[model samples]
Target: MKNLFHSYFESFKGLRKEIWLLSLITLINRAGTMVIPFLSLYLTKNRGFSLEEVGWILTFFGLGSVTGSWLGGKLTDKIGHYRTMVISLLLSSVFFILLQFPSSFWAICLGIYLVMTVADIFRPAVFVAISAYSKPENRTRSITLIRLAINLGFSAGPAIGGLIIATAGYSGLFWVDGITCFLAGILLLKLLHPKRAKTEMEDTFIQAKSAMSDKPYLLFILAMVLFGFIFIQYFSTMPLYYSEYHKLNEMQIGLLLGLNGLLIFLFEMPLIKFLESRRHTATGYLILGTFLTGISFLAINLSDWAGILVVGMLLVTIGEMIGFPFSNSFALNRSDGKKRGSYMALYSISFSISHIFGHNSGMQLINRFGYEFTWYLMLGFALLACLLLFILKKILLRENV
Candidate 1:
């Protein structure tokens, strides 16, 4: 196992400077994201509110993130990723500090939405930077490793957030996230100093825009949006399942979340590479992953054991191990380097939109329809994505590939 680990990491032996910087940035960014998974719970359970009210607050987060993602893309197109990232970090930090004040439910919701929007600017811009810096040969592994870092950070963040929420209250999360945002900006600036493009080909903003509008890319984006629609359920609904249905406490729930992160952290690098090596079926991996997530959610109904819930989550993690990075890589790889930030921003909009719907409407789905039905709904979304991607690939082959 140790030998395999060494050999696996050897794949990244000499990546472009930008890939490493982006990995670090991804790590820092996710560390701050400790809030998202827990925010709904904190509001509903800790603050003496109901899930429906929490849903409304979470909806704002989704909407704000969507708006921010769209606008950030435009900003990246106009200014540059580095500047966009800087502005995003600065704005997110200001909002994080603002969170320290006690406010009404509506006010808190507004703050959540605001920070979610402003803070999220880094990802697309960083994607732009990574695409700008890497060559096609190393791109898949490069993106995969970036994901590796993201999960590694996320691995720690949720577990830590659970601890902090228990000991320090929601306010503590704000302070930590705020400080991380400011430092993340500084780390990004220091690590990924923007380049003036040694050649015209170095930056591809206009080319990216043109390419993004292409049939294959647009269809792929649609698939991703649906994929996001299903995936965000993990954040919004899965917790409610563990809490209300499983009868688990925060500490136990935190362990499951932590275990989810650990699997991604420990196994994702090898698992993604292993999948990639068997065939060049990025689309297929996505379908399989999404299918498994739906199946796994259904499987949760089979057992009430918290340990079994971990088993189900492991399945979900494996599914993500196959799918999410595959979709991200495909979208970013197809994008032109200079305009990668904008392209990813738009891609991110699909994700943000789903989160909005997932948190707000998803709670309603659970409330009105029940948890099992929502999982079934997520399954349908995944199956739809599979069919769409298969058809889209066929079209791409005939038309573009």
Candidate 2:
């Protein structure tokens, strides 16, 4: 045990104090969020809204998040990540807490749309801080550590949130989520601060040259955007799909999502290590993940194979575990010194874009076609993503190397 602890601390020798603080911030914030994975259920069951109406609401949230992410990237560059994160957290909390009082559909939609903007802004800034605070060599591990905290907290949050919603109303969960935000923001405020790299004092030429010549990195971002569309099933249409096809109860859906989070937490680290060891093959993992996620929807559509859905999610877990860190590290590795955050921010945009379009569009497909057909369409999307990943990987390789 002592040897293991020593090795762990040794591995973290250069990790800054602030990054660790941000990890705590992530845990607290995610623990509080308890809302996202189950948002579809709450809106449908509590609000007496149709799945299509939920789609419209999600579209707005996605749109707001896109705008917020853009603003966050700009603000992080202009003002500071710390300041931007704090304000966004406070604002989103206010909007979330307001859900307690309740309002008409239009009013709630407007409020949620607005609040999600700030909530979206909070993510990029925190990540920018993550990139900034860590040494380049350890950037991947640090980001993985942050992801671990997020998934760890996230893993527990859904099951708890399910219980809360079962016992209390949706409003209670909103209140709890809001309070968690405030707590996370407070921790970041207390523990984190800006620290410049010593290399910043030297010539900036090194970073610029690295970024300008990085073909693989640019291609990686494009692929990430495509995969984001497929992976977004967790939020978009998957919940409704599970509910409708599998006839899953709220508790069951909650357990499935909790299991999803748990898989991420359990395998993400070792997966990252393995993927990085064969970095050249990251595209394969990307392809593999998308195929699994896309095809799983079919399994969900066909038999009442909730078990298959779980298995598919485990594939997703494997894919995400392999691809996400590899992609982030690849991006950070190739980022131009001053534009690292910008690169990350742009990569971040695709995820929200997928959420905005993927769910609503998938719903439309489902409404028009049968359930199985709609999934085939999603499967087509995933195949398209794989093709893009392959093309980009080829370019990234021959372009620079």
Candidate 3:
């Protein structure tokens, strides 16, 4: 047990201090991720919006995410990652607070759209910052560390958010979320001050290809879109599933959802460290991860017992731990320093596209065909993503040869 614990901590060694600081910033920002997880429920129950209206609002959220990601990339390239990230965090904090005031359908839609647009601008800039901060060999582990922070924050956020909702109402969630964002921004400015942190500059010597023209990378992005589409259903539809089908209350559902992040927080770093030592291709891990994720959906169908929900969540968490870091590394490895912002932006956009379609479609499917059918449909999406990844692996091998 002593040796085992030593090995786990050893995985964290050799990473730069900047990486740790970046992860700390991510943790602080994500720790207050109270609003989004509970957004659908708040819309339906508190605001008295129909499920269809909620779907449209979520779609607008996706649209804003797409816009933010693209803008962040362009801004990172033009102004640098540090400025982009700081600006994104500070501006989004205000928007998050403003989002609480809108009660009408169109007003709510516009509010969510604006808030997400500012909020998601953080994504690509942070990816670029990670690339700048990490060494080539330890980059994957660095990404995992950041993800560990994110999962840790998510682990706490839902449970605390649930308690807040029960006591203070949904409006309390927005204030906390906004405050955390502001705090994270201030911390970043103070700790990773522009003078202290390394700023990434475009390499004048290496000619970088535009991300839009990279066909193989584009195919990989498509697979990610599908993977994200399947995965996001957990956030959007699964909560409703727990409440309506499994007869779980808000607190119970929050704990169950929190279980996913808690599992990831505990296991993902060790798992990624093990995988990093292996000479496996990124696409190989992606294929296996997607298969596991698909199997998780089927796992839910295996038993009607509420215990099965735990089983399904565990499987999906494992798959996420395996897939996400590798995916980020793959995209980062493929890009030159000059165009990394564009590359990561396109990658972020893939998930943003999934957000646009995933929630609304999953809700529609459940309304028409029921939860069982929606799960099966999600399984199919995962299988399709696996297939695309397999093809991408073959193409990469051929190109390398």
Candidate 4:
């Protein structure tokens, strides 16, 4: 038992200090991620928007995400990841604060679009930073470490967000979100020196290939879009289901969402370490993860017991723990040294594209057919993603041979 516990901590050993700092910045920023999780509820309960209107707003949010990711990639290539991340963090803070002022449907839609566009630019920039900071051998573990920070923050964010909403109203979420972003930016400046990061990256620079020309990678991105489409429902429409079908309150919903993050934080790194040491193919893990996620949705419809919510959430969290870190490492590995910014941008864009259609469509389906039908439909999408990933694995193997 002592040896087993020692092995768990050993998994985190040998990662660069820069990677730790980067994770710290991510933690600070994501810990204030109170607004997005509750955005649908705020629209429905406080702003009095219909589900359709909220869906439209979410679509715009996605559009902005796509734009931000692409722009961040371009900017990261031009100005370096340091500048891109710093700019994104500070600018997004302002936009988050401004988001609270929009009262009308169109205005709120526009506000959300702007906020997300500035905010999501952080994604690609941070990916490039992770690639620049970590050793090749430990890159997967580094990705897992960063994800750990994100889920840890997520664990705290929603629970605290629920309290803030209950006590101070939805407007309080925005203030906290903005302030945290600003604080994270300040911490990044204080801790990570740009010259050192650039020096590290310069040592490994190579002639870059355009990410668009990479067909296999693009196909992989498609599967990610599908995976993200199904996964995103947890944040977007599933909360509504919890409220309407399970009669869960805001605090209860927050706790449930926090549970997903908490589980991932506790288990994901050691799991990734065990999987990585086995040297299994990335797609193999991806297939299992996708299947688990699909089954999680089905679990929701299995019983009327509120305990089923916990069951479903556990499955989703497990799938995420299995899939996401390897996905990051795979995408990074596929990229050439210098143009990694562009490659990671496309990877981030896959999820953004999922957001474009996933949230609105899930809400529309729920509005039309109800939550149970939507859950079944999500299972179908997850299965489809698994099929695509299987095909991708075959193609990749053929290329290697």
TM-score to true structure, per model: 0.85, 0.80, 0.90, 0.88
Per-candidate Cα lDDT values, in order, are: 0.74, 0.70, 0.87, 0.87
Residue-level lDDT of model 2, residues 1-401, one tens digit each, is 79755654554456678778888888888888888777778888877788778777777778888888777766665556677788887877787787656556777677767777788787667776776788776677788888888877877788789888889878789998998898887776677743442233132334334322456555565566667876776755777777887789888887887777777755566555555556555456666666666666555556665588887677666767766776666665555465554555666776778777766676677788867787677677767777777787677667668
Model 3 Cα displacement at 363 (Å)?
2.4
lDDT for each residue of candidate 1 in 147-166, tens digit (9 for 90 to 100): 88887787778878888878
lDDT of the structure predicted as candidate 1: 0.74
68 Cα displacement, candidate 3 (Å): 0.8
Top-TM-score structure, candidate number:
3
Tens-place lDDT digits, model 3, residues 360-384: 8898899999999889988998999
> What lDDT does candidate 3 reach at residue 299?
92
Off by over 4 Å in 3: 41-48, 159-173, 193-199, 204-208, 239-255, 302-308
Clashing pairs in 2: none
The regions of model 2 sitting more than 4 angstroms off are: 1-16, 37-53, 99-102, 162-171, 196-222, 234-256, 279-310
**In candidate 3, how many Å is residue 204 off?**
7.6
lDDT score of residue 225 within candidate 1: 80
RMSD of each: 3.4, 4.5, 2.7, 3.0
What's the true lDDT of residue 97 in model 4?
Answer: 85
The top-ranked prediction according to lDDT is 4
Query: How big is the positional error of residue 260 in model 3, measured in Å on the Cα after superposition?
Result: 1.7
